[model samples]
Target: MECARKDRDLEAEQALWQRWQARRDAQTRAELFDFYAAWSRVLAGHYHARYPHPLAEYADFVGLASMGLLQAIDGFNPALGSRFKSYAEPFIKGAVLKGLACYIKDHQQTSRERLLSVAGEAEEGDDLATIVNLTVGLAFGYFLELGILDAELYDNDPASLYERENGLETLAYLVEQLTEGERRVITGHYYQQLSFVQLSEMMGVSKARVSQLHGQGLQKLRRLYEQVS
Candidate 1:
């Protein structure tokens, strides 16, 4: 019942948006504002929590994010056959970040290159960022040539499976098939750059147990890859 009600609300909202889009209605602007205002605040909070500038307030971030949300709404076309939420969320968040960047540029007198360098360093070891682009996911993308992951995987398109290899999504799905200990062992070893000894220490298990987990994970990954291929 709740799901049906939510769906009805969404249909109504989209219908209203379509009308606003046609006539450029002022009330439609207000409706968009009311709908996304709280979301803007939440996204702004994420920036505020991690941003380097101490003087940057939550309200300021919210204002910046809200502009991004508005831009998304203005540019959106229903004919694209894409979900508005999916397309708009990234656009809004990107706008907020860009706005913050501009503010930083004006206030700090710092170069954009320096800010990018610092941000890069902060996200260097994060797994989600590491595996973000499928192109990079194959050969470990950006981490390639650094000996972080095997180089052969880079030979294929990370986005599409031309060679019938397991790719990133398949690997993740396979990991879901693993026992928790096995998953941790593999993630720590490859993704987190932890040695077997380190994993053993962290998990409060023997080195042999860690080795067993690693073996299990590898086996599962191999099977999954073979099945996909």
Candidate 2:
């Protein structure tokens, strides 16, 4: 009886995937998302439990995991003969890690900015020197924190290193396939952490243009990812 029930559930899920893939049915996709919502949250909770960030709440991880879950749903290939959960786990984890990385980076940048602001406002002589020293100490601390976090996130095992290298190579290949404008926007925004406003100023284009390029670039990347997957 239990086996029969499980089979029925699997059949229902397979039907949903077929409808979404064939027709890009919005309702089917939404249903799939709702069905897997709890699973996404469980994955998020697992990561949060392992690596709790002071600045990031559990809800934040859940939100990031949802983005990953959506990507998984969109990119998943039923023809690949792999279970959806198996394929989606990596995407979901990657999204959470990427979000955590961005959060830490932003926090570090903010700390540096605050330090610089303090140094700029400090009185000349001993006060200025003290502020500079404090800034240096804080910067060093942030650097160490990043190093430790990275080490914790990525294991030193051979399999892990190989997987990381392969993932980077795949990403590089995908980036290379982008148009010049899209390439610039994607690289500058992601790698350089430049905002659309900053990219606009640097590229001598309007912010709207930068945003459009960014959207186009991401769309292309998504298609490329699906192809490769």
Candidate 3:
């Protein structure tokens, strides 16, 4: 009985594919997607479970997987004698990874912008200190993000994958030198993409205090760099 049900489901799927190929209409395309949508969700859930990102919600992954499923339905050649599930799995997984890569890139950009904002808020007559803090903050932020970076989290672009091999080591050393409060602020903001407000709430402090810690962290990193150089 189980085998019979499986055969029936397969036949229905094949019929839908044929109808889609014949008319190439939106209705048929959507029907095909509906048939495979559950499988796409399964793939999305699988990948999300395997590589959870702090910045990405599970729904984000599901949406990306849906896009991949649509592509698979549009491009699949049934005559090739391959199962649709097998063909679509790679497409779905690829989409999820690609989406994650974009998310990480956006987070990194936000981190830079926040660093710049913090630098701009520095008190007058601290021009030199602000510049140094901004430079070190940006550098360390990038490295911290890179340290947790995965190749699969990168778009399949080779240039995007290019990273300094020593970045992780440098980031670790600098981070180690930070005071406990500074470490919490810097790591929470850069590594987890937390906002100053979020870090403040987590640490039970004022947002201003969190920002101050972040700036002090960057200054310490700069001083450490100067000492090493």
Residues 1-229 of candidate 2: C-alpha lDDT, one tens digit per residue: 9999999989999999888888775456656866786688788889999878887866567767877887798898898899999999999999889889877424454343334432333455666668766565445323322322121336789988877666666766887899977777666544433456555655567876766676566556656866896
Model 1 regions more than 4 Å off: 104-229
Scored by lDDT, model 1 comes in at: 0.57
Pairs in steric clash, model 3? none
Can you list the residue pairs that collide in candidate 1? 136-141
Order the numbered candidates by lDDT, best leading. Answer: 3, 2, 1
Every model's TM-score: 0.42, 0.45, 0.45
- Enumerate clash totals for all models, in the order shown: 1, 0, 0
Worst 10 residues of 1 by lDDT: 109-118
lDDT (Cα atoms) of all candidates against the true structure: 0.57, 0.67, 0.69
Q: What local lDDT does model 2 show for residue 128? A: 63
TM-score of model number 2: 0.45
Candidate number with the higher lDDT (1 or 3): 3
Q: What local lDDT does model 2 show for residue 36?
A: 80
Per-residue lDDT for 127-160 in model 1, tens only?
6754353222233312211232222355556554
Residue 114, model 3, lDDT: 60
